[model samples]
Target: MYIPSPFRDDDLENMRATIRCARLANLITATSGGPLATPLPLLLDESEGEHGTLYGHLAKRNPQWRIATIGDAMAIFTGPEAYVTPSWYSSKRQAEHVVPTWNYIAVHAHGPIEFFDDPDRLLEIVTRLTNIHETSRATPWAVSDAPVDFIAAQLREIVGVRIPITRVESKRKMSQNRPMPDRIGVATGLAASKLARDQEVAPLILVQD
Candidate 1:
């Protein structure tokens, strides 16, 4: 992540918040075949290590788990992102130098990757993951919702992942580089947008006030 000084986010809590909100992550690893990436839901355990630990699973048939990874694995998490038009920048009218850019939040975690197929651990990981995503629903589902034998059989088809995070890089590119007037223009413009992502980005920009 190329983060300018203005957009750099070093706050651990903020980075964790972004990861939590972004349920899914792009897990990438360098392999002999080339680079492989998989999109999966990862749970971050902030108390684990210097940075944190990531937990997730991949389908047993996914060759990524069986491949020999050369170096550290990277997990990318992205929050709300929106296209910012030149019309949203007040500077566009003043100097016409401002073009278009994007406003978004992203976090990257790097660490050695480990894959395991221990049934007990896999069971616990599956249970926790299920609860995290379903807890908000009226009829929340659980691993126990299904028969014990059925859940055990299902777990056999997946491999567990554990990455003890060594470092984290985060960026909150919400037009912090723009002047107050330009930022206000962006906030107002995004707030009025019919696109849900654009509207979600509005509050983040407004907080810069």
Candidate 2:
């Protein structure tokens, strides 16, 4: 996360928002063998620890959980992202220097990685995670919907993860480095893009002022 001063997002609330909106995250760990990474749907517990805690699980057979991490693990969460073309810059017409870049939001959370197999804690984490994602559905599902034996059998196949965040680096690169005219040009160009992510990024670029 090489964030320039202009693009750094230091606001705690904003950082939390980005994490919450990110449904999936890449969990990376350094091991004696090599680096291992897994993509998982994670839940952030902002109430825990100074920064926060991340909760997720991996398949019981996944080797990543077996290896001991040398240091803190990193959870990478990415928000809306779009490619920005130099043609969108007003400087293009003035023969001024301009190059293509990307506009996006990302958060990197680093913390000590803890793996657990306690069924109670696993059930709590899984239940909360399921509720969070299913709340928007007309027929929201719950862990209690399944029989106790069935749920216990399913839980046996997974292991729980708890990462107490020690550091968080957030970046929101939404054309904040560009001049007003260039930003407007970018917004206009992105708004017209056929990609939904580009359209979503267009407003963020325009709202930065």
Candidate 3:
């Protein structure tokens, strides 16, 4: 990723936060045939490695895992992203020098990829993944809520995935490079947008001079 200095994010905790908030990740691997990718939910275990470890699963039928991976795998997590119009920059009105750009948050985790099918490991991964999402529900569900045999049968159809993240790169491009007036204008413009993603980005770049 070609991250400009203003957009680079190096804080480990912040990067982890971005990963945790991301609903899904693209698991990509370089293969002899070609690069294969899978969109899946991944759990980050912050304590497992120097950076962290990722846990997820793919359907047994997914061929991406069946191929021989050449080297490191990469998991991409993207957060709130929105198109910024030139109209939002106060400087645009001054000299017409400003152009449109994007404001977004992204994190890339790179490491070795491991695939496993052990029923017990698969069961644990699914159960943990389920709890992470379900705990926020008003009426939360649990793996134990289903029949033991049914859960086991379902686990048999998927392969567990683990990646110990060795390197990570993160970027937070939220108009931080813009002057105070321009950034304020951007925040106000985004806040007025009806799109939820735009609204989410409003406060990220919001600052008081």
C-alpha local distance difference test of each model: 0.92, 0.93, 0.93
- Please identify which of the two predictions, 1 or 2, would achieve the higher lDDT against the true structure: 2
TM-score of each: 0.97, 0.97, 0.97
Cα lDDT tens digits for candidate 3, 39-138? 9999999889999899999999999989999999999999999999989888887788878999999999999999999998998899899999999999
RMSD of 2: 1.0
- Model 1, span 1-209: residue lDDT tens: 89889889898999999999997899999998899999999999888997889999999999998999999999999999999888988788778777899999999999999999999999999988899999999999888989999988988999999999999999999988889888899999999999999999998986752
User: Ten residues in a row with the worst lDDT in model 1?
Assistant: 200-209
**Compared with the true structure, what per-residue lDDT tens digits does model 2 show for residues 1-209?**
79899989888888889999998999999999889999999999999988889999999999999998989999999999999999999889998688899999999999999999999999999999999999999999999999999999989999999999999999999999988999999999999999988998988997774
RMSD of 1: 1.0
What is the TM-score (0 to 1) of candidate 3?
0.97
